[model samples]
Target: MAVLMEKKFPVEAGAYETAGEVSTTIKRTLKQLGVSAEVLRHVSVACYEVELNLVIHSDGGALTLQVEPDKVTLISQDVGPGIPDIGKAMTEGFSTANEEARTLGFGAGMGLPNMKRNATEFDIQSEVGVGTTITMSFALDMKG
Candidate 1:
């Protein structure tokens, strides 16, 4: 599929000061491009979830947005301390978030599950000591 637009934002670990900015920018960009409200809503949720995951879990990473004719894709790639258990992590209430994250009310173990639930297609890959990458795609409603 040909990409109509693409943007990447770098996320710093534990950077609570600027946590949700990237996802907000993504949503706004998509909205400015005249994307359907349904698709924009899904992308917003999944984008926020994945961006928070990068901040709370991974060392550091980049979140990328790609807009295609048929779909919008969000890719998050992080550096280290990758997820050890994919199955457990996928559980709705399973969280490895530290006390700091908990105090901020950010990590409720719903990030991954919510991202998956909001996207039309979701895929995650991780390797111990390497990193984790999550890719989520939302199919655009092109029937205007």
Candidate 2:
């Protein structure tokens, strides 16, 4: 389906200074669009998690926001140095984040797990030396 509204934000690697900015914008946009509170909260959490993942783990990436009549979708696609094991990456508390990322209070390893938990539908694909792509959707309906 065609997107009703869309925005893209570039996430620089290790850019802790500006982390969560994209997600903040997304949350505001959804609120302006009159998305339900429950769905907005879920999308906010998922978007923050994914955006932080891009800053902490990726070489660089862009987060895309798509709004449809029934749902909001967030897609994060990063450059090289992709994940080696998708299964391991999905595990809570399992993070490949470096000391730099960790020192900044990031890399707690909850990014992927939290995103999956908050999103109505989540998908992640990665290939070593290639890139990683994560897609998360939050439904507009009040029912989970």
State the local distance difference test value for candidate 1: 0.90
- Per-residue alpha-carbon lDDT of model 2 for 1-144, expressed as tens digits? 778988888999888888989889889988998998889989998888888888888899999999888888899999968988889888989988888878888788888988988988999989999999998887789566
Give the poorly placed runs of model 2, Cα more than 4 Å off: 142-144
Q: What is the per-residue lDDT of model 1 for residues 59-111, given as tens digits with 9 covering 90 to 100?
A: 99999999998899999999988989999999989999998889988788998
- Model 1 scores worst on lDDT over the 10 consecutive residues at 135-144
Candidate 1 vs. true structure, TM-score? 0.95
Total clashing pairs for each candidate: 0, 0
| Model 2: how far residue 18 lies from native, Å | 0.7
**What is every candidate's alpha-carbon RMSD to the true fold?**
1.9, 1.3
